[model samples]
Target: MNDKRKKLFLLDIDGTVALGSELLPGAADFLQTVKENGGIFCFLTNNSSKAASDYVEQFRDWGIE
Candidate 1:
């Protein structure tokens, strides 16, 4: 029998993932690595300046989704 546990990463958007419209160095690679390792990552934000839809659009523009 084989046992493996799924991993989940909850990351912050600002500074952690990106600063403004730019993606931080290695952020993309880190996320890709998570997927490659059968892990799931979700973005988290404490800023309420933007709506969820706006973030979705921004993420798409950044090639995150």
Candidate 2:
């Protein structure tokens, strides 16, 4: 028998993951760790000022896909 559990991490974008165009300290590391451990991390934002494409571009600038 095989036993494995899925891991999902729901994170905020503004203050938790980043501030403006900069990513907070250890944020990248934490995300990388999650990926390395076979976990998934998703971003959640309540701000409606920017479009989803804007965030995609921003994340690309930070070397995150």
Candidate 3:
């Protein structure tokens, strides 16, 4: 474990992770991979038009944790 390292990923939800209201291709898989590799991530959005629960449901719809 000498090469153990920490990684933190900050991802935007609007365009990077999703488009309009749909999750982009591979976005879910990418997040899953990061978790599998012991990496941390935070998903954010500048738009406040939607509620936090909406985002959670969106992620759930996209099959992402």
TM-score of each predicted structure versus truth = 0.85, 0.88, 0.85
How many clashes (backbone atoms < 3 Å, residues ≥3 apart in a chain or on different chains) does model 3 have? Answer: 0
Give me the overall lDDT of model 3: 0.86
**Over 4 Å off, model 1:** 1-6
Instruction: Report residue 38 deviation for candidate 2 (angstroms).
Output: 0.3
TM-score of candidate 3 versus the correct structure, residues matched by position: 0.85
Model 3: CA > 4 A from native: 1-6
Clashes of each: 0, 0, 0
Off by over 4 Å in 2: 1-6
Give Cα distance to truth, residue 47, candidate 2, Å: 0.5
The alpha-carbon RMSD values of the candidates against the true structure, listed in the order shown, are 1.9, 2.0, 1.8
Q: Write the per-residue lDDT of candidate 3 for residues 1-65, one digit (tens) a residue.
A: 57666589998898899998888898888888889998989988889999989999888887776
Residue lDDT tens for model 2, 1-65:
57576589999999999999899999989888889989998999999999999999999899788
C-alpha positional error of residue 3 in candidate 3 after TM-score superposition, expressed in Å: 4.6
How accurate locally is residue 3 in candidate 3, as Cα lDDT from 0 to 100? 62
Best by lDDT: 2
Give the per-residue lDDT digits (tens) of candidate 1, residues 4-32: 76689999999999998788999999988
